[model samples]
Target: MPILRRFQSRVKFFKASEYMQPKAEVQNLKHMRTSHLVEPNLVGKHTLHACKRLVERILTHKEEKAYKVGIVGTGGVGKTTLAQKIYNAENLKGAFSNQAWICVSRDYSDITLLKELLRNFGVHHEQGETLGELSSKLAAVVWGKSFFRVLDDVWEPEVWTNVLRTPLHAAAAGVILVTTRHDAVAHATGVEDPHQVDSMSAEVGWELLWKSMNISDERDVEDLRNIGLDIIRKCGGLPLAIKVTARVLATKDKTDNAWRKFINRSAWSVGNLPTELRGALYLSYDDLPHHLKQCFLYCALYPEDSTMSRDDLVMLWVAEGFIEEQHGQLLEETAEEYYYELIHRNLLQPDGIYFDHMRCKMHDLLRQLACYLSREEASQIILEN
Candidate 1:
């Protein structure tokens, strides 16, 4: 009797264990479905020396419970690429318990941004929910965990207040990284100094150009190398410009004459740029203040790779009536502010060849953009040659 009762008890225990197995499986599935860790592929030899150090601090620094890092640069200056590299670094892989990247462009909607972010977290939403409700829920769920969030292409400061400022900030281990082209936006969103990404150097630009053409750098064909170096210089050390111009040149004759013709041709005659590069360059131009728009386009008057002094450029603007005399400010002073703003925004390069900050040069592709937009969009006045 005792043996039979013991066997019956064992049978009941086995039945209960079987019943819990499906529940355990369901719980495991639920846990597995919510993972949002992302490791992006790092491309190019960006060698972002400054950016890497900032990223390292983000990964290892435990001094702060939470913080925000700002990456500010002009479009196509490789901000996105640098951010991707930071996101995928070995030090960052296990640094955060959860990770998400979201694009918060100028057109981003508050509700949509929250919903997308939640979706990245593998959280589903009903159609009629309000932003407040979503934010509360997100904050609740993300409260105790370490969260690494990347907000790419942020345009307005309101994006932070509405979307991530409360929830992510409340998390004890949250680190929010934001990318913006505007210094104002960067300063508003960050608690620390924002890293300003600079244009690639001439050597880096040449490497990128050659890499785009699938050519080896080891073989130094002198004539072709000279023209290629000249082309790189004309590209103004902007990677996208070098890439677009190189891709265009790749389809032409392999000889130096073909490249020389491309270099010699007026930017206005180069026809359309690669739409990707054109659109990226145009956004920076489009964002300029109306009063400064013509001031910037005036840069196209100079030849590609030509350097002009700031004083000369400002004087020209004043002569052209682009600069209006403001109350208590010299026309040249106001115009110099415009020049510095352009340089600050990466629209113009300081003349490194002359090693003079007083001098500036327009990138050829940007010159192409300026000339094209001035003609097509504004019907800008053209002085006779």
Candidate 2:
């Protein structure tokens, strides 16, 4: 009886331990799911192909230097879209045991940024550490592991040299991919000839438009088709512009008059449309708030892609009679407010924001959009030109 009682107690103890084990395991899984996670989505075929080739090169050559792949193009040209696709590809998931995607916006703080990167690597450090110490912690975490790090929408080389590259270099076989709108940025990063992505083909553009419009058959309306082609041409092969216009057209019933109206409205701007990129950027410009509209249009006074000094731009704004002075606010301060507003809207890219922060010039597409709006708003000025 005593032996039997002991046996029964042992069985009860084992049963309790088994029941609690699953609960603890489930809680651990939930914790893991909530922490240091990345979710990826499909981009398109062309982008996926490019990504696969890059991953293969990285995996095949352990001794070879890590490749720095860059995607460069005008804004809204789908650089990020393509980069995301490559990052999320299922086949390439095993290439790197540890990967992180960091979006370096204009407002990235160095220490905070390092913490985010380390968190992805499953390294936890106390919050109030110095930038140097945080970088050291990050370096230690990535030391042995092969890392795939993507710095998306990089606007400055200083950020790369000072903050990201130092620690990232410690990781063996680490691949860094950058996406940007500027050629000089790629050059500054020492990438051997960044890949410049051009606008989609007209056929692809049309297909994208159809997808956006949710239209199945182009054959039902021949006249509409002709007008649509003309509109697509006006867009300058920009996917964004094509899709926006298609959405606009799609909402209206299929009719020759409706198609003609769109064509005619877009027709008068003929040669004014930017030649470098089809006018997909125009829609974004047209949607700007009034204050930003004035600020962007004011950029036309400067040369194309010419970097402009922040103080000089403000002084110019004061001299050109655009900004009105208010009590307790200098004209320079008012001008800066507008500059930041434009930057926030993705209308302006920061040149450098140090002791003497100087902002460079706008992209050709943005300049063109500004010019288009300026002409449309002040037709008399355009007519004189």
Candidate 3:
């Protein structure tokens, strides 16, 4: 009995030691499954090409100066998808010693949130410390190291300037990638010219729709293919709209009349569809003070994809009596100032050339959002016109 008891005690001691081992060392052994990593499903050649460019840039400058890559486009335009694909690509993964993916959601400035990012990088804090302490600890871990950090869905530029840039400044030769829907935010990052992710082409959009549908039928294949192409055209080459519409169509029985109806609906029109990219714009529109909403709605008078001269847009607003003139500033100049404010808020995009510099244009998606809000406010305008 005494000999058996001694052997049992030895076995229990070994088990406790094993359990107490550092988690970081055992992470691979315990989790070894690649399934644990959230791999983004990125489709289309455009996305793949962007990823290749990013990887090449990072490699080319790995030993030189730090590189920051900004992937900018409308929401649901596949910015995050492209960034993730590049981050997880086998070649890129092997090139960096440490890789961290952080999501900078709408409200990303909370210190606790920043600490969570550091934790993902395998840095832990002592109990009862503030975020500043944690930030310093993270700096120590990342500083002077070759690291790959991806800030996904970044909304506010200040968040990047304050939280990310500070720590990143310490990490020599590290690469930072930011994905944002706002060009102003990209500009604020002080990174090189952003790689813009535009909507997919018609061919690519149709291919994506086909994949998303998972359609397979010999008799109906021809009809379905035609419907898919038509539907893709209505999607304005936006991948999100294409995928969502395709999924919606897939559940319905395939029929010529049904497909035709789907293609003809104004709701599917590129200028009318409610897009995921427009959701943020809608929120901003909704939050606008009543007077501002009216002022913004007056912008729809401009043509789609057409450049609205800052002077012209403002003058129209003033002429239509949208702006209240103040002393010292000319009414046209005041109106231009208001237009600039809207530009700063991302309510309008630069049309590539203004009175010399670039002027402003609303994206099709944003224009649609503005029109929808306008219609909701004064249904009579759209109904009568």
Candidate 4:
């Protein structure tokens, strides 16, 4: 039970949500159409093509064949944005008899996830006392329904595999679309060939940056255009990063000298990040429960783009006293959970998982941020070498 407590420590107690409206009893909600309507605005040619392909597949599916499609991409490449656009498409709107959107974030639990699903379907705990009973109640609530579900930001395959059967791989003609940052998660959940979202092109990146800032595409403003392009270049084709940088530029002075000064200022000295991307990434980091912050920062020791061995990272965290033993839990187990949290939050990558070892990597921009944040700790690593 020590391990159980340790794992349960991470799962927040599932609370009744205000989002659960209609106020129906569990038996009444066998099918509910709860849709969190996100307004869809997709950009760039490649992104448009990806959306078109996915929509085309859904529209033409005439089989009992599985409709489990996985959209895989690195953090900030905009998988969620693409998913929302596809979900809101005209064809997709009437494709299923029922639909719901649930975000299974980094800190997630099957029990909590089930509760959320039941709540989304307009169910109230009019009676179950155990998880299995709750599960049975959930199955009964969703059983016979033709559903379109989106499990956004899935960090583990178990989230899908462990859910009620009809939610995925059902014989009925419904679909469950998944979005994740891990390739293995896609395969483990039965997605054979996942749609991989690559970074945007430089031209597309500049277009989005300027579009967000309401700047003209004309070539007349040569000085401003040149500086803006440099800023966009530093964004490295990441849509979220470029968007955040554009937000920062929106309020600033548009003079050539001001833009030049921002470009020349050292990201390290500012203790933030290049291109103003730190604000976005830092929100992800800051969302981590206090226990995992040090472990997340410890990742900076591995060089940029280097695949850090999962076991090695755990041991290093243990040695450095970053992981405190809790409720008779093994240090390694808590450390593993810490790793999963970081990956789930889009702060780390799951490169490969082997029988004996799991490999993880940090993105280049995130690595830059970690070093900037942990300057003193990173200097210790540099000195020991």
Which residues of candidate 1, in runs, are more than 4 Å off? 1-46, 220-223, 268-385
Tens digits of lDDT, candidate 4, 1-385: 2222222232222113222222222222211121232312346888778888988876666233446788999887878767877777777876776677766655455666677677767887644356676677776776656677787778898887776454434335566788899999988987768899987777777777677666764652454777777776666677766664665565567777787776665541334345544544554454455667777766665433445667877876676667877898899998887877666554665543244337665755577666666654445555766
In candidate 2, which residue ranges exceed 4 Å CA deviation?
Answer: 1-49, 61-66, 218-224, 266-385
| Candidate with maximal TM-score | 4
Q: Count clashing residue pairs per candidate.
A: 0, 5, 7, 0
The sequence of per-residue lDDT tens digits that candidate 3 reaches over residues 223-271 is 6777767766666677656654654566456886787865655443234
RMSD, every candidate, angstroms: 25.0, 21.3, 22.9, 14.1
Tens digits of per-residue lDDT for model 1 on 1-385?
A: 2222222333354346432243212221111111122212223454457557867878765335557888887765766557766776677777787777675655456776777667766788776788788898778777677878778778898888656778666566877778888989977775478888777776666667666666654664444677878877766666656654554666577788887876765542334655534432554565566657777776665544345678877876776667767999988899999888777555776653344468765655577777666555432222321
Candidate 1, TM-score vs. the true structure? 0.59
Instruction: Give the TM-score comparing model 3 with the true structure, all chains together.
Output: 0.59
lDDT of 2 at 3: 20
Judged by whole-model lDDT over C-alpha atoms, candidate 2 comes out at 0.61
- Give the Cα RMSD of candidate 4: 14.1
Runs off by more than 4 Å, candidate 3: 1-42, 126-128, 217-221, 265-385
Model 1 superposed RMSD (Cα): 25.0
lDDT of 2 by residue, 166-219 (tens): 887777777777888898987787666677767776656666665656666757
- Higher-TM-score candidate of 1 and 4: 4
The estimated TM-scores of all candidates read 0.59, 0.59, 0.59, 0.60
- Candidate 4 stretches with Cα past 4 Å from truth are 1-41, 62-66, 166-171, 216-223, 268-385
- Evaluate all candidate structures by whole-model CA lDDT and list the values in order: 0.63, 0.61, 0.61, 0.63
